[model samples]
Target: MIKIKIISSKETYSVRQPVLRAGKPIESCLFDGDDLETTKHFGLYFDENLVGVVSVFENKSNNFHDEYQMQIRGMAVLEEYQKKGLGNFLINQTEEYAKFQNASLLWFNARETAVAFYEKLNYTIIGSAFEIQNIGIHYVMYKHL
Candidate 1:
């Protein structure tokens, strides 16, 4: 059985480090606003082990004029768990939570490879592709709630 629930920012680092920052240090997973009062992290647990994680921040983008918006960061699922629908499950849960928080939209800097994945989920790409210093190319993707 898969269970999804709110988890601490610290707890999310375990999955985030391994899945999102493989060669980098564990500290790389510690994102800004991760410990903020309004920030929320979701964990996907299969049986008792956490297999996927995503962090959402209550932030408004200049590109979006919406009063309330949320940014998804460090979304990752374990390599072995990739094609099992856990990613979609985590995203659906995040959208529900964002709606509950009164956010009008959700956005994220998705990796270029994941653009099609987000598109399939109804998120549209905005602006040109850009690099994130250490990371490769990424596209800004968003979905209106």
Candidate 2:
């Protein structure tokens, strides 16, 4: 059975380390606001095993005008779980949660490779591409809620 639900910040490290942080140190999986009161960590479970994760922070980006905005960070699914609609499920669930919280916009810095995936969900690029050290090219993407 597959399930999606809110998870603790620590619960996300297992998937984040292997998928998002890759060869980097485990400490790299610890995002800046992972423990913040306003942040929420979500997990995708497969037959009782954690296989995917995404985190959202109540962060505002100057590029957008929405008073209530949430930034998505550390969205990842294990290599074995990719292309199985698990990512879509995770993201859709997160969007619903964000709407419930009164967030009018959702944004994130998406890696070049995953830009297409995000585009499929109606997220559009906001500005020119940029590079994040050790993370290659990225584009700032956002969607109005």
Candidate 3:
């Protein structure tokens, strides 16, 4: 069985390590030294072991802009935990939280390999693919809340 929860500071390190291992040199902004200043992090647990993690953050805009959107970042499922629907669960939870925050949309720079996965979750790509060192090809995908 699996459980998902909002993580507090004390557990942030534990929750973040797996994502770091998964992304390696491309550690997402969520793993940055000042992550807490910009993102809300969450974790997925399998029988008491941390198995996946994701970061959610508000989109930056011009001082006068009032648009509201949330981006999902640093999403990863441990190698042993992949292909079991945990990724979908994490995305669902993230979207639910985005809605709770009154976000109009959910967006992410999804890895190319993950395009179909996000597509299955109903996220649509808005442009051409791009590359991020150590992170493979990526596309800007979004879904309305």
For candidate 1, the per-residue lDDT at 96 reads 96
Per-residue lDDT of model 1, residues 12-118, tens digit only: 98898887788899888899999999999999999989999999999888889999999999899999999888899999999999999989999999999888878
1 versus 2: better lDDT goes to: 2
| Candidate 2 lowest-lDDT run of ten | 19-28
Per-residue lDDT for 53-119 in model 3, tens only? 8878887423213379887877778778888999999999999998888988888888888899899
**Cα lDDT, model 2, residue 55:** 96
Instruction: Rank the candidate models, highest lDDT first.
Output: 2, 1, 3
Cα deviation of 7, candidate 3, in Å: 2.0
What's the TM-score of each model vs. the native?
A: 0.97, 0.98, 0.81
Prediction RMSDs, each to the true structure: 0.7, 0.7, 3.6
Clashing residue pairs in all predictions, respectively, total 0, 0, 0
Q: Model 3, 43: alpha-carbon shift in Å? A: 0.4
Off by over 4 Å in 2: none
Rank ordering of all candidates by TM-score, starting from the highest: 2, 1, 3
